[model samples]
Structure formats: C-alpha cells, structure tokens
Target: MRAGPLVVVGDTLLDVDLQGTSQRLAPDAPVPVVDLAAERPRPGGAGLAAVQAARLRTSRETVLVTPLADTDDPDALKLLELLEAQGVRVVRLPLSGRTVRKTRLIAHGRPLVRVDRGDGRLHGRTGLPDAAAAAVRGAGAVLVSDYGRGTAAHPVLRALLEELPGEVPLVWDPHPRGAEPVPRARLVTPNREEARTLAATARTARSGGYAQAATDAAALRARWRATGVSVTMGEHGALLCTGDQPPVLVPAPPVPGRPDTCGAGDCLSAAATGALAEGALLTEALEQGVHHASVFVAGGPAPRGSDTAEAEPWDLVRRTRLQGGTVVATGGCFDLLHPGHVSLLHQAARLGDLLVVCLNSDASVRALKGPGRPVMGQADRARVLSALGCVDAVMVFDEETPTALLERLRPDLWVKGGDYGPLELPEASLVRGHGGQVLLLPYLEGRSTTRLVQRAHSEGGEER
Candidate 1:
C-alpha cells in the first residue's frame, strides 16, 4: 500500500543513553560500578514521533515541527540527522531554554537511573505557532504526540486543529498529568492507566477487569468527543472503541520469548496513523498498529540497536562451498523474455556450476523506470526465470539498488551484460568490496527486448 503525507506535532526531547556491563563492586562505595561501553543519543518526543511516521509512510512525505534550543545539544543534532536521513522534513523553532534531555544509564540490558533536564515548555517562543499551523495545513492528517513536556497544549493544538481541513483526521496520544482542555481529535490513543486518568476513575477499577476496561474506554471516548479510542494494553494487545461500530479487540501477535519492550508504543501510533491516512477503517488501522508494535517488541530493525545481527556474507559463502557448488549471480529487471535473455542465461550458467538470478520486484522496477513501465509482473518474471534450465534460483529485491542484497549474498563471481558499464552495475562495489570478481558477458546486439517490443507494436502483433 502507498503511504500518504503525515504531519507530526508534539514535544521534542533528546534521549541520552549509556550502555555498559557491571563488574566487581567498587571499593570506595558499596555500589556496583558499571564499566561504560558506549553512550548514544537519539530523537525523543515529537522528533521520535516524526521518525516513526517516516517509517510507516515510506511512500508519502512526512513533516515534523518541534522546538529546539540554540545551545547546540549533541543529542538534538543526532535526532535531526536521523530525521534528515529518513527524508523527513523538519522545522526547528528556536527556544531560549535548554533542550530537554533524558539520560538513562543501562546496565546489562536493564535501565538503572534516568535523569531528566530542561523544562518541557515552549518558553516565549516566537513564530513556532505559525510554523506549526502551516505544517498542519499541508498534511492529509495530523498526529499529536503529547509527552506532557508542554509542546502539545491547549493553544498550540487548538490552532493546529483549526488550521487543518475538516475531513482531515487528527490523532492524539494524551498524557495524564496534563489532560485538561483536550484538543478536538478524531482518535485518542491512551494506555489503560492514561485512559483511567482521563476518565477520572480508579485505575484498578478501569484496568483490573476486561469488562471494566471496555467500559472505561467507551466512557473516555464519549467524554473526549472522539470518534475513535484505542487503549493499548501491553502484552494483552489493544482494545479499540469507535462510534457506531462494535468494539474490536486486537490481540497482540505472539512474541516468541521475552523482549525489551521499548519503542513499541511509538511504533503502534505511527502505524495506526499511516493506516488511517490510507482510508482504512478503525479496526483495520488498529490491526496494522498491533502488527507494527509486535515487530518492534520482537527486536526487529529498531533505532535502539547498534547494528542488525544478520547472517554475514561469509556465512553464506561457507554454506555454498560446503555444497560443492560454484555460485553464479546475475541481476536485471528482466522485464520481457526474449531470445537474447535466454542466450544470456545459458552463457551465465556455463560460467559457473549453479546460477542464481536476482530479479527486481515490481516496486523496484517502478522505482527505476516510471509507473507506466514494467510491462510484466514480478511473479511472471520469476516463473520465466526459474523455468530456464540455466537458472537455479530466483530472488527478488524491492530496493532500487541491490547493494545490501549483494553484500549478503557474497557470490564467488558476479556477472552482468556487456551493455552496462563496469561502474554502472548496482552491485559492482559490493562484489569488489568482499574480494569477489565481476565479469561482463557478451550481449547479442540485435536480439534486444526493446527492439522486439517495438517491432511487435509496429506490426500490430502481440507476443505473449
């Protein structure tokens, strides 16, 4: 599904985290000293919401508006860099107060002490309201992430909502401490405790029983005049309440084992906003949100991790060597099947004992060419490639560049057509990076698929 443009407004903070291991007790004090391994900073608050929005709206544009201090906070800069890398547009409003920073010390995968600095307020900021309203006006939907740091409050949120088109959806993640004068929002996402607080009821009565939780969710939705309400119940999944529709229970996908449950809520809110922007019903959006949260809880490619622990290219190399096969690799769009393609496949097969053709998926082809191109579908192309006796395996990639896939495959030899320049091949650097050699095969000059298609079109002939 295609993603749509989303505008995210909320509190912006910096997360400074320290990671280390605890060794023998310190002699000076009766406390365990953690040997610092590394310290890192990431985007938190509204910046974090923007980052999450970028991930969900892969196709659509994302704009984030938040306040930052001119004091040159390294953590704030890192967050900006990350948002820029994800192609998210950011508008920074300068503030006189220091940028909020939350520093957490983690020992053996557990959080120790969390120190917070800076008051979470706009603090006599100029032009921020106008800039934020402009951002909201340009979006299909707006998401407000209220970390209770004071970025998302009455006046700012009311201004933002008024600026948006009436049909445009508004989603809010409310904070308990500052729930007064709730902004008019289409959807409100709150955890069980937050929902109880918003409803001004006992936390245990609201969350202790399933029936009570459902009652609380409905009451809160009605009180806030929201069209939809989603209460995220960690481990148990989420409960959704919508106007005129039966309440839907979205069960969390099974997490294989114990997991570090950080960033799950952020992921959920991002996915839900994306799904809603795509015109999905509330239930469908809730399901998609749960799915996204499950992936993060399962330790997927999250911002918190240093590097993804994927199988190294050498591992695949060793496995292929053990099978006593010479691995052959080739790549192309393979849009239309023709005699030249058949001939090239045979030639590539002869160069090695086994041939693996990497076929670009439909999305990849569309990215390379325009949307009107890719005359054939990915499945058909894969079927044709696999049917050829010269081809052993067919793999598909959805990236415009196959550098990541090539780095993973690490074939013994990489082959390409003579038509492409040595440097033009997408996998050229990757092949050479791991000491693999690249070879160019001779092309049948006249037997081109483009020429064949042109001839057929001119002659009023169809080849299928």
Candidate 2:
C-alpha cells in the first residue's frame, strides 16, 4: 500500500548563510575583515523539517502546515519557492507578522555570527483553513515542529491536533515559547536544555549528562501525557523514555570532525516522522532518526561547489521526483560506449527530466556476457557515462538484473533499447508494479558492441 503524506505542523523560516574569507585584522577594529564569497539560502524551522522529510518521499508526500505572512516580503516569498522546489506542499494559515529570517555569516567554513529578524506568528484571530485541517486529518504521521512562532499555540490548530485518531502517530518537537503539546502525542522531542526547562524540577540537577537527559525525558513524558519522550544530546545522541522502562541510549555515529549541527534536531525529527509514517516502531524510528541526523550533521551545512552537472544517482532520482519531474532509468553492461548506446541515452533523456544509467558491475557483466566481456571497467564506464550530457547520473549494480535498483529509484520511465518485447523483461513487472512505465526503444542500425569487438580482434587492434 502507498504511504500517506507526513505532515509537518509549525512555523517556517528563511535561513541564509553568508560565506566569505577572513584575512588580516582591520586597522580600525580588533576583528578581521571578511572578503565576501557566496550566499546560500534555504528553508528553516518547520520549512526545514518539511524539506528533510521530502528527501526520501516523492513530490507532495511531505506537507508543511504553517502560518505564512500575507505580505510580499522577499524572504518569505523566497522561502515559499524553496520549499515548493524541494517537493513540500505548503498549507498556509494566516500570520500576524513578518516571516522570520535567520542569517549566519561564515568565514573559513566556521560560523562567525548570526543575525535573526522577523516577528511572524500565527494570527490571534485566525481560524484554521479547510485545507490545513484536511491535511492534518489525512496525515499518516504528524510532526509538530514548533519554533515558538505561535502556529502550535493557535487554538484552532491545537483543537484539531487533539482530535486526531489514536492510530495516527503524533510527534511533538517542542520549543520554549511554544504551547504545550496536546494530550496523546505519540512522542515528544526536546533538546537537553528544553527538557530541563519544561519539566521545571530541580531533581534534574541530581544527575548530569545522559543521566540528566534521561531523567528530564521521563519526567516530561509523564507531565505532558505523551507515550514517549526523547531528549536529544548533540554528538552524544538521544535518550528515549517510554512506559516506565529504562531509558534507551541511541548513540550517534562518531564523525571525524566537529560538524555543523544547525538543523540536526529538525533532521532527527523529520527522519523519525517519515519512518513512523511508514509504520516503523517508535524505537526503530528513533534509531533511524539518530543515524540520519548523524549523517546530516557529518555532511555539514554548506554545499561543496560542483564542477559537473551530474549528481549522485540516488540524489538525482530524489531531486527529480522532489521537483515533480520525471526520472528515466536504463540499464546495460555498457562494456563499450558505442553509437547505439549514445543514441539510446539521448532518447531516454528526452523522455524525462533526468536520466540515470544503471550500468552492470564488473562481476555482473562477466556473469551475463562471459569472462571476456566488459572491455571497460565499471568505474571507467560510470565516469564516462556521467560525463555525457544526456546522462544525469550513473549507478553500477552487482545484480544480474536492475530490479533492486529499480525498486529503490522507482523511476517514472524505464527505457530499454532492443527488439524484444517490453513486458517480457525481468524488471518490467517490478517497474510497472511501482507505477512506472516501461518502454522499448529501437536500437540504432548497424551499431553493435559485439560486432565492434570482433572487428577489433580481427584487425589486431586493442579494444577502445
């Protein structure tokens, strides 16, 4: 069965990073002067939660339910576009003020300072929109990513949240200034500090570190009437408390360096929400959340400059689907790049917004085409295909067929160049089962890899 959308309910913000170089100290001040470089902007807060959740989901599968200001503020408009571009469907409510924007200045890859502005909050007199209410009711899992921007405090929304069915999992990521989570929240997430502040008991001081986090999580779980509570400890990971059981320590994977943890909380919450939406147990979801959040932090906050148009194969597929674009995939040994291969790739590219070539691994190629086959190594073939304008990405698979990769990618179109019937192919049923179309494109005449190989051998020429 298809999974329902994961609804992220809270405040959205615009986050920008101003990256630059810092050199000699200024003559007039003690601080060094910064030479400006690139400016990167992305969604923050609930918007961030939505974007993170959308990473593994298809277009419109992650919904952001937030209060958006009706004004024409550039930051607000930009945030809206960015969220939509990442495949988040926004269900906007009325806002009483300007949208929040947080700008950080970074020099030499380290954050120097942060400038925050905007007073956006849910309008006091605002009523829940029909669409927003409908989204909550239809959510497979709900994450209240409250940033204390008043969306979580809105009475109409709070009432709606309280009325959700028991089967629906509700995760509340609390903020200091946000309203308390409604009763029956399946889980409540709070950082180490927030847990202490919300629980409001000096007993937390009786312990320190993980012990304190565990105590606070347990206290808050009971106080807030939530089934489970998780206290996130940066780098250390999270402490989960549930039903009088001993707290579980879900450790974060160790990274080589101190990584930027700007959105680690949102990443964790979003990952857990997505897992829960797909019916994972709370413990399993938290484990996934920890792993995903760790990877997210390890990747850091800034994007590395890319010199090529091609992206990682999985990323290409995810990004295409997120942008509501079609993804096309084709598979082959591709031992030798030939005119027929290039022609098929070109045609596949035209059928979708992105084309991923699933190349057979060296082992798989040998298995399928004999030991003497695969004139080129898998790595060289992947590199060559990635350099092609018609190919957005290349994925090498060890399996005899690409059914496993097809299941993972779920491409919109699976194109194959041959004279064989399309439905008879091994991966055709798998692609069709996932709502993808399979098409057989005609091969270029007089262009064959085997023929080229034979000619090269007869002429005493090495394979190209």
RMSD of each: 11.0, 14.1
Clashes of each: 1, 0
Give the Cα-based TM-score of candidate 1 against the true structure. 0.63
- Candidate 2 is scored at a TM of 0.67
Cα lDDT of model 2 by residue, 21-138, tens digit = 7778999989878787778899999988888888754333788998887747888789888888877889988887798899998776678899999998888755778999999888
Candidate 1 stretches greater than 4 Å from native: 1-4, 94-96, 125-129, 154-156, 179-184, 202-207, 244-246, 300-464
lDDT of 2: 0.81
For each candidate in the order shown, give its overall lDDT on alpha carbons: 0.71, 0.81
User: C-alpha displacement of 117 in model 2, angstroms?
Assistant: 1.3
Q: Estimate each model's TM-score.
A: 0.63, 0.67
lDDT of 2 at 104: 95
Clashing pairs for model 2 are none
